[model samples]
Target: MLDINHIAKTFNPGTITEKKALVDADLHLQDGDFVTVIGGNGAGKSTMLNAVAGVFPVDRGNIVIDGEDVTDLSEHRRARLLGRVFQDPMTGTAAAMTIEENMALANRRGKHRSPFRWGITQKERSMFRDELARLGLGLENRMQAKVGLLSGGQRQALTLLMATLQKPQLLLLDEHTAALDPKTAAKVLHLTRELIQDHHLTAMMVTHNMKDALQYGNRIIMMHEGRVIVDVEPEMKASLRVENLLEMFEHTSGGKLDNDRMLLS
Candidate 1:
C-alpha cells in the first residue's frame, strides 16, 4: 500500500527559472491496486514517482508505504522496498552481465544471504529457468548470453522478471513500453498484466498512451498541472470514451491541451 499526502515540489525555487513540478499532489494505492496514469507533458507524473522513489526529496509533505513514513529516506534506502522499471530500455539492467547474472542480482537485492556465490545454486537456477520460461521468449535457453545482446522487447521482459523476483513491496513502471515497437509493446503489456495478476502486485504505471491506460488497470487517473484531475474506476464509468477523457482534461485544468509535443508526439 502507498499513501502520498499533500506533496509539493519545485525546482530552482525563488529564482527566475522556478518550475513547479508538483503542487500538493496526493495519491493512494491499496494492496494489489494496479493504477495506470496518463497526462500531457509536464503533468508531474514522473515527478510524483521520483518523489516516491526518492530520486529527489519532495519540497513538502509525507510519503508512507504500508504505514512506514519514508519521506525522509535516501534513494538507496528506499530502493530496498521499491521496484522500478524506467522509460529507457537501457536503464534497468547491466548490459555486460549475462542474463542469469542480471537476474541473480535482482533476486539478492534486499537479502543478507551468502554474498560469495558466483553462480546460481541448482535450486535458484531452476527457479530462474521456470520464471524465464513463463515469458515464452526462449530466454531460458539463452541464460548464458549477455543481456546486452537481447532485443529491446526481450530486455524489457527480462527487467520485468528481475523486478518481481524479489517480491518488491511496490512496483513503479514509467512509460515502460514507449520505446518498443508497437508489436513488441503489446507483447510487453501482455506480460505486464500477467505478472501483476500472478503476483497480486501493487503497481503504478505512468503512460502516454490513453488507450493503454484505459484498457488496462482497475483504475485510471488523469493528471494536469501537477494534480490528479480525474480519477475513475472501471465500474464507475464503464461507458467512458477517449473523447470524454480529453474533455475532462480540458475542463478540470481550465486549459486546452495545446502542446504539440503531447498531442502529436
Candidate 2:
C-alpha cells in the first residue's frame, strides 16, 4: 500500500523560471491496485512518481508506503521498496553484463553485498533461466549473452523481469513501453499485465498512450496543471472511451486537451 498526502513541490521556487511540479497532490494505492496515469506534457506525471520514489523531497506533506513514513528517506533507502522501469530501455540494466549476471544483481538488491562474494550458484542460475523462459523471448537460452546485444524491446522486457525479481512492495512504471514500436509496446504491455496479475503486484504507470492506460489498469487517473483532475474507478473506467476521457478532462480541468503529445488512440 502507498499513501501520498497533500504533497507539494516546486522547482526554482523564487526564480523567474519557477515551475510548480506538484500542488497538494494526494493519492492512495491499496494493496495490488494497478493505476494507470495519463496526461500531456508538464502535467507532473513523472514528477509525482519521482516524489514517491524520493528522487527529490516534497515541499509539503508526507509519503507513506506500507505504513512507514518515507518522505524523509533518501532515494537509495527507498529503492528497496520499489521496482521501477524507466522510459528508456537502457536505463534499468547494465548493458555490458550478461543476462544472467544482470538478473543476479537484481535478485541481490536490498541485501548486503561484498566484492569478495559474487558468484552465481547453480540454483539461482536455474531460477533466472525459468523466469526468462516465461517471457517467450528465448532469453533463457541466451543467459550468457551480453544485454547490450539485445534489441530495445528485448532489453525492456529483461528490465521488467529484473525489476520484479525481488517482488517489490510497489512497482513504478514510467512509460516503460514508450520507446518501443507498436507491436513491441503491446507485447511489453501484455507481459506487464501478466507479471502484475501473477504476482498480485500493486503498480502505478504513467503513459501518454490513452488506449494503453484504459486497457490495462483497474483505474485511470488524469493529471492537469500538476493536479489530479479525473480518477475513474474500475466499473466506470472499464466502459470509458478515449473521446469520453477527453470530455472529462475538459470538464474537470476547464480546458481542452490542446497538446498533441498525448496519444488519444
The C-alpha lDDT values of all candidates are 0.87, 0.91
Q: Model 2 over residues 1-265: C-alpha lDDT tens digits?
A: 8998988999999999999999878888889999999887888999999999999999999999999999999999999999999999989999999999899899998788841285888999999999999899999999999999999999999999989988888999998998999999999999999999888899999988888988998999998888888889888988999999989998998888755657534
Clashes of each: 0, 0
Compared with the true structure, what per-residue lDDT tens digits does model 1 show for residues 115-192? Answer: 336558888788999999999999999988999999999999999889888777889999999899989988999999
| Candidate 2 pairs with clashing backbones | none
Off by over 4 Å in 1: 114-118, 258-262
- Find the candidate with the highest TM-score and give its number: 2
Candidate 1 lDDT for residue 204: 92
Model 1 residue 180 lDDT score = 90
Roughly what TM-score does model 1 have, to 2 decimal places?
A: 0.95
Residue 208 of model 2: what lDDT? 88
